[model samples]
Target: MNQRVLAERARRAIPGGVNSGQRNVPGLSDLVIAHAEGARFRDADGKEYLDFHAAFGPPLLGHNDPDVNAAVAEAGNGADLCGVGVTEGEVELAETLAELVPSVERVLLTSTGSEATFHALRVARAATGRRLVVKFQGCYHGWHDSVSLNVISSAEKVGGRDPISTGILPEVLEATLVLPFNSSQAVRQAFADHGADIAAVIVEPVPHNVGCLLPEQEFLRTLREECTKAGSVLVFDEVITGFRHHLGGWQAISGVTPDLTTMGKAIANGYPVGALGGRADLMDLFSSRPGGPAFFAGTYNGHPAVVAAALATLRKLRAEPVHAHVFALGERIRSGLTEVFDSLGIPALVTGYGSVFVGYFMTGPARTYDDLLRNDANMFIGYRRRLLDHGIFELPLNLKRSHVSYAHTDADVDRLLEAAAVAARQAGGEVQDLAAASTMGGAVR
Candidate 1:
């Protein structure tokens, strides 16, 4: 079937014709992916495109990796789901997490990143006996009530209560204190004013949600110091940065450990798995014992197949040169895109950490959401949309980072750069024409 037929059928079944709100972009929503292999996927119309989105950075090793798939098949042959007791895979996965991640002395498994963050916040509130939670403006922890506000807010609502979705209670919105990213003073002040009432401060170490607002080392250190001084739990939501950035997580690079860490995305190489780990005392609160303060239960928390996928993915990451390969490709894409835009005389900034890149239509580096306020949203979106027409697939949305999977090659990087130059020229010409037309109209007046 064609994309149009599939899309029409989907809209009648799924709300908004997409399962996730982020998948509902104009150019992307209509696309029906027929199949995906390493580095590329084909649409229902039988056209192939080089995939840089990597399904929002989950396919770290790439789509349909044989090793990961083999592990899943092997594990599924022996065991599936036994909800009553723990399996060997579950114990091994948790042990592996504790061994790999720095902040994890103890851990709990969940089915999704949202569940992990929800459990982390609950543990923090219970451990501290506090009511308020702190999060940065552009950092998205999860879709949960506690950290759902102030992501991608407008200028007027930058520092205010701008809930991403309706149906969140007023009390829930108020409970979350949204502050600016990369501001040491703002973090310190929030802790000073509400130190006694604060339960936790959660941040996305790099703020990839707003297309890579690189966190200052001092800013992260300030978070650690203030949270320590205020006796509040510090949580790093590394769902996007974990495993993909480094085998040890972003904390290894920054050396600033959090009281709790929530991780997912590439953890299982596109399989459904998430984990929350932290200081042993704090994690013990999730125990179902009589005196345990927090509650945590899920039937599919540690499904055998998911655990197998994660174990296999982590093992491959440890044994192979996955990080080395992807990181080099990431740098290649960033530099290539920078050269392309400069040649076109288009003001742009491409910023990201290992294996991720985001092209921002702005004048300078973005340290915070406030800095990103100057980003040209229309040009950003238009450039990505035009890239799709050139057979390169990135989510045509503002503030979304593109991923480089281990499956991609140096040749693929060069092809993307060549296509990007053409796309940039097209998008740039349209913007220039619009500016000229506006100036001429003003002169006539």
Candidate 2:
């Protein structure tokens, strides 16, 4: 069936024609990809698109990377859900993660980033003997009750207990304190008011959830210092920035180590895997031996095939110049986007680090979620639709960020720039001379 028909049929079985809420939004492209390889995916209708969403930021090596697939196949040869003892693949993955992330001394695996963050918070509470958890307003740790509030709330409800989903206990909301992102003073005030009861301060380092607003160096340093002084565990939720920003995660680039780190996404090259690692003294709480205070276990914590895929991904990252290539593509996209928008007399701001970025259709930089709210959302959504029409697939909505993958080539970058130029012209009501704008392609490069 075609994508629109498939979606309509899915709605009869699923809640909104999609399992993920982001995929069910209005005005999104009606596309159901049948197969993906390298930098593009083919829709059911046999149409191809250059993918910029990168499956919501997990396909760092792109779709169906041969090396990662081979490792998965090899691990699955004799793998079983024995559920009796540890697997060598899990141990090796742990060792690899420990060596890569500077803050991870010991590790525990989970199946999703949400579970990893939940476990990290549990360990923090058990170790600190406190119940209060502090998180930045715009930052997203996961969808769990503990860190779910304030992620996509309206401006007035920014610091309030507005749960992303219904049915969360009000008590769960009470235990979390939501503060504004990139504000050191707010962090200090929150810590001052409730430092003695604060268990952990979890942040996204680079809060990509709300379209990639960066943290000022002083803000992160302040978090590290304040958490240290107050005895509160600082958790860097690097789910989005883990290996995509740098080999060692954003914490390494920021030079501020957290007491706990939650990572997923690019770690397994789109496989189902999540990990929480930090100070051994803290991670040891998950120990099953007598006297351990915290509990964390998952049925598929380190499935052999998934762990093998993660190991293969990490090893390949170690051996290849993947970061340099992706970073260059990201920079090119950012600059090219700016040029396209400028040529059409449209206001835009392209911001992000390394392989991730978002284009906001507003003037000046967006430093907070509230700032992002100022964007012309309808125009941005229109621009995304235009890109899709031009065979450049980005996640729908203005607030969602886009990703550039290792599989994306210079030609892919050039094509995306060309599409953006055309999209921009269309959005600005300047499409009458699209042929002339298309001829101005070299300007973006």
Q: Which prediction has the highest lDDT against the true structure?
A: 1
Best by TM-score: 1
User: Worst 10-residue stretch by lDDT in candidate 1?
Assistant: 436-445
Write candidate 2's Cα lDDT for 1-445 as tens digits.
8788876787788887677778865665465669999989998888888999887899999999999999999887877567758899889989989998999999888999999999889989999999899988778887789887888677788767778888899999899998889999999998889999999999999889888898899999999999999999999999999999887899889999999999999999999999999999998888543477787678888889889989999998889999999999999989888888888788889888888878998987688777887887767777888888888888777588999888999999889888888887776563324435668763321
For candidate 2, give the lDDT of residue 382.
Answer: 76
Residue runs of model 2 more than 4 Å from their true location after superposition:
287-290, 430-445
Question: Model 1 over residues 29-48: C-alpha lDDT tens digits?
Answer: 67778999999999898999
Q: How accurate is candidate 2 locally (lDDT)?
A: 0.87
Cα lDDT of all candidates, in order?
A: 0.90, 0.87
Model 2 weakest 10-residue run by lDDT? 428-437
* Segments of candidate 1 deviating more than 4 angstroms: 288-291, 436-445
